[model samples]
Target: MSFPQLLTLLVIALHITGIVVATHAVMHTRTPQGAFAWALGLALLPYVTLLPYLYLGRSHFSGYITLHRSHRQRLSQASEGSELAGLPPSCTRYGALARMLQGTFHPGQQLRLLIDGEATFEAIFDAIAQAERCVLMQFFIFHDDELGRRMQKALLERAAAGVQVLVLFDGIGSHALPRHYVERLRQGGVAIHPFATQRHHNRFQLNFRNHRKIVVVDGWLGFLGGLNVGDEYLGLKPPLAPWRDTHLQMSGPAVMDLQRSFAVDWHWVTGELPPMLPPRPAQGDAYTLIAATGPADPQESCSLYFTVAINAACKRLWLTTPYFVPDQAVMSALRLAVMRGVDVRVLIPSRADHHAVFLASTLHAHDAIEAGIRIYRYQPGFVHQKVILVDDDTASVGSMNLDNRSFRLNFEIGALNVDRAFAADVERMLLDDFGKAVEITGDEYRRARYPRRLAMNVARLFDPIL
Candidate 1:
């Protein structure tokens, strides 16, 4: 055939492949809207969308379930003779969300809420410096910035001092992280690996990211929440300055749960479990459960966990998240909570780090306000904390965001504390945050600039992936 004829044949073949992929999407996409969007893109704009879809369209995570099951079985066997096999009946009031996480309630945990990056990093660094046995650290975004270098120094110091250090970062989240950043730590005797999901079965599937930020020292002290190892997290970055976030530092049996989570991800990456020490004796009496959910789960565990927590609210439900694009179930639960005379409040950022997500969140805020749920935006800076307080005695803090990406796409974790004292602390912290935020009334969206309003609606269409 002539060159022109061959070009024509290639175009025809590409269109046919697009159609086949679109059909497959219609059958396997998680949401009807996602399916329709992909199908339309594939059929009408194959040249632009085909390659991107090949990487971003997948919903299931390969090889994760088998690995997770094996880990769960081993953990079960290890705890067979322990008294903490499960939570007491009194703890069942938190609902069945624990089962979804494959986590058990850990009692006698001393929960200390770290308000922002300064306090969080201070606590984390102190723990790492005090480490005698080992340090396991993980973050989705491990930036090569000032704060990241400080963290690197801390780990290197500990590693050089005869402390074993293992670091795992998300391959996609930290793709921009320089090789030398991690190489220096490895050279200092730190074991570092990327939690990658590019195996043969799920190659090109770049949607499932390990978004949990966990730091465990000596299998006893654990820290986790929204802060990553970046200058932005520390309010050191201009334009996103005065960053507002939250983290938790815990000791006692609860730390073991955090250690287990780290070990699971470590094993997934290196096929070797880190040392699992027995749970330390009870240090203080606070109940906490660690909920780790991801695309590997059979059901939407993160979404269900949020829904259950919202539904269990009798008096109030206050949440802080950078993103607010919740799924149908969670949205319904929020509306129902308001209808049942519960005070449902959502706190998001005034100026978001993500433009499309900020626009989508504005639309969600409008919907929430119409449903009688009060929405507030932090005024001084970005609010990146993932925290939820229910009624008077339940609160959660960790890396999960209030969006579809966190609900179904990311490997997320949350520490749910069911203690009145801890909940009160969370409430007080949120109250201060609310004081710094501006409440969104229905008029806010109605009076938005025409272009801004239009952009919001358009962005809402991308909620499934945002």
Candidate 2:
């Protein structure tokens, strides 16, 4: 065939391939809405959807079009291994979620909530500086400011001293970082990789940004919480009012799970795979379960986790998120939990990063109040933390907001502690924040300004895409 005929044939083949792949993905996904969305995109933007799948789809048999297959394999391996290996002795009789997580990382896990941003930073930075072997980090925004530079300097020193170091930063999130930031680390022998580069504008790639903020060193120490690698996360300087956040510094067998996550993301950024976290004896008095959910599997795992946990709640459920635009499942579950007398309470930012989310959260919350679920809006500083305290024995903390973006698009890692003491501590911290918040009632809900109601409804319509 001539050039024109050849090109036409290629286009036809690619379009057919796109439909098959989209159909296969939707079938594997199982969610009707997700299937419709994927199929719709494939039908409308055939090339855009097809090209991304060839590279980023979950199929291993996709051949040259198989994108991130190695990374996906590493994720599956790490998730499965850590989930089964980390169960603490005290957690021998725990639930399925705990079991699955325990089968992955350390079972005996105790986590302390560091609420103050500065205090959280001190805990994390000290741990980073003390890392004896490799420091694995993946952050959404590694700003180019004072805190970012300070971290870069320390990471460089450690890497130069032959400490194994790998860092992953999101391309879009960390776009403002100095152009030479990665180069600076490269020159110091520290490897750095940007997740989802500009050349790959894969729709899901853009949607599934790594919102996880993780720090793991020597496979013995790991930090997960709200604070990103920035001055603002530390609350030293706030872009909008004073910043408030939380973090957890964990050492014990559970650290291995966090370490595993770091290693996988590190490998994705750099071509070289990092060492697996060797199993260790359980530490601490509490049973801890480490769980991660993301696009790597084409499953919205965090949202599913939330549903599972919420459904399992029989007594009480309390959630705090800076962003509160929850997915349909989450909303229904919370409402149902309340209807079942679970005493559901959701704490959201009285003032947050986006008016749309904040307002939509209020609307959902209005219904929650009517259903006997208490809702509070924190009016002090911005609550940049995300945490869920369920009943008397479990608490989950991580980078996930309750918003749709976190549940449907971005990657999130949450730590579930089965220790009563730790869970109580988290509950108390949440209660403390709740005390500083203003509770909303039906009367208050009815009194919302017309403009505000309009804005919130508009926001609700966009929640699916948030």
Candidate 3:
């Protein structure tokens, strides 16, 4: 056969393979829009779409799910005869949300709300300095910038002081994290690994990302929330300067659960559980539940967490997130909450970090405004906090955003605090944020340029994978 004929045959074979993948996507994609989009692109433009499909198409992390279920079973059997679960009785009210996450609302968690990058990094560094036994740190992004170097130095100091320090960062999120940044820590006796979904069966898949940011020191102190390790997180990056974010520091029995989450991810990456300190007694009186969810979950745990929290709101629900691409169920829940007379408000960034996400969020915000849910855009710098305030006695703070990535694809964590004082604190913080934000009026969408409006709707088409 002629060489050109053979080349044409190879091209046809690739197109056929793309079609087969598209068929699989049609069967497995969780949303109709995603299915149609993938199928169309794959069938018509195999050369362009096939490679992206390999990275972005898969919706399920079956490999991690199997490992998680097996490990949970073993852990359950091991703890069968241990003391009764320490979760408070009121936690049962969280219902299936709590069970699906396999966690309980343990009383006696002392939580300190860290308002911005400065406060968060200070608290984290102080805790690491005080670590007596071990320090476990994980972040979705770990830059080698000034702030990142500060964190590295602190961890190195602790490691040198006879503390066992281990760090885990997302392989994809921290892809640009230089090798020397990691080697510096390892050279100083700190053990570090990158969480990658590149195992044998999941080799071609890169959709799942470990987006949880957690820091545990001696199993007594824990930090989790929106701030990643970078100069940008410190408000040092121009244009996005004065970065607004939120993080929580917990000192109590609940830290054990946070540690467990880190251990699970660590085990997944290293095939061995890092040594954990025994549970310490309760250090505070606030009830806290660490809701860790990811693609491995049996259900859409993060989405349900938001829905449950929204449903639990009797009088108010105020949320702040950098991304506002809520899935159908969550959008429905917000609308229903408004219909039920709940004061629902959503705060999103006014500036664009990801132009596509910002555009998509504008449409979602307009939809929310039409449904009686007040939408506000932070006018100062970017608002990157993931916070939820429900009524008067419940609040959640962590890394889960109001987007599909957080809903199903990313490994996320949320600390749900059921306490009146914490709720009041959250309310005050949100009030200040709302003050800095401008309300999106009903006509805001109508006033947009036609081209920009068209772009937003086009961006919305990518919501499933956004």
- Top lDDT: which candidate number? 3
In candidate 3, what are the lDDT values of residues 26-53, reduced to their tens digit? 9988778889999998999999999988
Each model's Cα RMSD: 2.4, 6.3, 2.6
C-alpha lDDT score of every prediction, in listed order: 0.87, 0.71, 0.88
Model 2 ranges off by over 4 Å: 1-105, 197-205, 237-239, 277-280
Per-residue lDDT tens digits of candidate 2, residues 218-249?
Answer: 77777887778887775566555577687887
Question: How big is the positional error of residue 389 in model 2, measured in Å on the Cα after superposition?
Answer: 1.0
RMSD of model 1 against the true structure? 2.4
Which stretches in model 3 have alpha-carbon errors above 4 Å?
1-14, 74-90, 200-204
TM-score of each: 0.94, 0.81, 0.94
> What does the lDDT come to for candidate 3?
0.88
What is the total number of backbone clashes in candidate 1? 0
